[model samples]
Target: MARTYHVYIMSNRHRTVLYIGVTGNLAHRVHAHQDGTGSAFTRRYNVTDLIYAEPYADVDEALRREKQLKRWTRAKKLGLIRRQNPTLQTIQGPYG
Candidate 1:
């Protein structure tokens, strides 16, 4: 199978801590976070909940989206997250 890439967001329970990241293996990446091995920010702030994600054909596009998300203001990013994830629920495990 071909490897897939994704740009994703992780947020805290209150949807306060937002984390933007890119990964070639979404499941493994999310699992790492779930296992407390993802990133310092996530571990420190308990940002292990997957809030949103967008898949891309390649790393370039994924990186572009990741950067864009990072640049968005907190409110704007929250709007985006709410649009895609109305209930602010975790994605319930990684998907392709």
Candidate 2:
């Protein structure tokens, strides 16, 4: 079965940088981020932490959310992250 996932936001411990992304496999995507193979921005910014995510049943919804996140202001993004992950814990590694 094809899996769909919503957009997600990731940040470092200090929440100094943000990485917005979408993937059908959240675990795999998070793994890639931790591995530094997700994207140049994430790798450069050391955004290997999964701060927030919202699942969507449809790919279109996920894509829309991703776009919306991209357009969000920094404060809005921080609020979103803080709502779900106030402590800013590192998303466990793929195997972990």
Worst 10 residues of 2 by lDDT: 87-96
**Runs in model 1 with CA error above 4 Å?**
none
The Cα local distance difference test for each model comes to 0.87, 0.81
Query: What total of clashing residue pairs does each candidate reach?
Result: 0, 0
Mind giving the per-residue lDDT tens digits that candidate 2 earns over 1-96? 657685888887687888898888888888888899999988888888887788888999889889988999999988777787777676564421
Model 1, span 69-94: residue lDDT tens: 89999999988888999988999863
- Candidate 2: deviation at residue 78, Å? 1.2
Q: In model 1, what are the clashing residue pairs, if there are any?
A: none
The window of 10 residues in a row where model 1 has the poorest summed lDDT is: 87-96
Off by over 4 Å in 2: 91-96
